[model samples]
Target: MTLAVFRSFPDFPPYGGEFEDLMPHLTVARDGTPAEMRAVEREVREHVPISMLITDVQLMCGSNALTA
Candidate 1:
């Protein structure tokens, strides 16, 4: 899927093609202060093992815009 996206938009490679392999992840928080980040980590650790069904995905790009 990543490769296909790269092919379609040669100018906008995933992560600017910086990484050799991509690891699936979920962003819990962004730009949080150190103390806030620690609090988030503690909260997340309380639910160490999370499970869910990902039935669909939406590709977003370009600064708060939904691309697809």
Candidate 2:
């Protein structure tokens, strides 16, 4: 699926071509302190093996909203 998106939008590369491989991940927090980050990690660990049904994808370019 990632490859298909990249192929479809060759001009807009993932992460602006910063990364060669794309992996499924979730950003728990940004610029968080060590203690704060650890707390979030512990909380996430409590709910291991999370699952969800993705029905739509949203693309954002800079501050512009682009729905896909």
Candidate 3:
């Protein structure tokens, strides 16, 4: 299993001296057969906390399904 984290900050300026908080995200991937990947996806969806939103998914280049 592999996990990736990403953070993004907007360019908009704040009213006060402080800038906006940075956004954080998490992405999980399991290198395996299609069936195994599906199983892992279901498990993660059920177990992971609700605060993190799995908004988008992009398979890595040469990755299992994307390459096929």
Candidate 4:
């Protein structure tokens, strides 16, 4: 199974958990090729979420950057 971590940034919620606020998320796509996996890993190391990796780096999906 792919390793996905959810790190907490700022501070952990009062609920209390192993992770803080920000988490290190990870996931392995069973259908993804070796090259794709490598790229995904890189994105994760850079703190990018899987969705962004898939859309921006892989370009497999549309990268719809929303405005605040």
lDDT of each: 0.75, 0.75, 0.50, 0.42
lDDT of 1 by residue, 1-68 (tens): 56766787799767767798986667788768999999999999999677777765555666655322
lDDT of 2 by residue, 1-68 (tens): 56678788899887778898788676667668899999999999998777777676555677444331
User: What is residue 62's positional error in candidate 4, in angstroms?
Assistant: 34
TM-score, ranked from best to worst:
2, 1, 3, 4
Tens digits of per-residue lDDT, candidate 4, 1-68, equal 11221133324232244444644344444458899888877866786434544332211212352211
Better of 3 and 4 by TM-score: 3
Kindly provide the TM-score of model 2 when superposed on the true structure, using C-alpha atoms.
0.64
Q: Kindly report which residue stretches of model 1 are placed more than 4 angstroms away from their true locations once superposed.
A: 1-16, 63-68
> Who is ahead in lDDT, 1 or 3?
1
Candidate 2 residue pairs in backbone clash: none
Q: Whose TM-score is greatest here?
A: 2
Off by over 4 Å in 2: 63-68
Q: Give per-model TM-scores.
A: 0.56, 0.64, 0.32, 0.28
lDDT of 2: 0.75
Tens-place lDDT digits, model 3, residues 1-68: 11232213223222221535633435477378899889888988897674645666453432354445
